[model samples]
Target: MRDLVRQGWTITAEETAALSPYIRAHITRFGAYATDVPGIEPEAFDPALDEIDFTVLDLAA
Candidate 1:
């Protein structure tokens, strides 16, 4: 998309309206949505994830 702009390729307002950031073609303007999430069983916890060190980090800017 950056290359297109560098090459002078331009998008009209209507064309831009048809496109979206990150996610595309999955948006619903108006609709009723429902899910039976309570009926689903949750995933079991993994004890192996506790072995990773979380305190070590290079947070300096």
Candidate 2:
């Protein structure tokens, strides 16, 4: 997840900062992808499905 965030995977700066803590909490409890993350809905991850109301984040260079 950290690598994905660093590689610019449609996440915000604030969201990027929060990933580590979220990952830590999740790891301590259940571990990686244990629960649904807030803001990023489940459907947003589906490559085959198109979403009409999604904002595309500019990937960092």
Candidate 3:
């Protein structure tokens, strides 16, 4: 999270609006966690989500 802040990411008003309800209902129910990612807007965040590549680890192997 700190790294994201250093990278210039900020949670936008639109992103807050889009995520607030779900976050409140689901995430908060579990416990508090930081969801703030500064610098990018909601629209930008959606496209950025697609660009992420996750490396799969075969833990069972």
**What TM-score would each prediction reach against the true structure?**
0.28, 0.19, 0.22
RMSD (CA, angstroms), candidate 3: 21.4
Query: Which structure is stronger by TM-score: 1 or 2?
Result: 1
Better TM-score candidate (1, 3) = 1
The TM-score, computed over Cα atoms with residue i paired to residue i, of candidate 1 is 0.28
Candidate No. with top lDDT: 1
Q: Model 3: what TM-score?
A: 0.22
Best by TM-score: 1
Q: Give the Cα error of residue 15 in candidate 1, in Å.
A: 0.8
lDDT of 3 by residue, 1-61 (tens): 4677789999667866775434444355766755786665555334455555555445535
For all candidates in order, the CA lDDT equals: 0.73, 0.59, 0.60
> For model 3, what is the alpha-carbon lDDT of residue 19?
55
| lDDT of model 1 at position 34 | 61
**Clash totals in order:** 0, 0, 5
lDDT (Cα, tens digit) per residue for candidate 2, span 1-61: 6788788887677876775544444344744564555776554555654655345454432
lDDT of 1 by residue, 1-61 (tens): 6788899999677987887676446777566566756687878988777777756755632
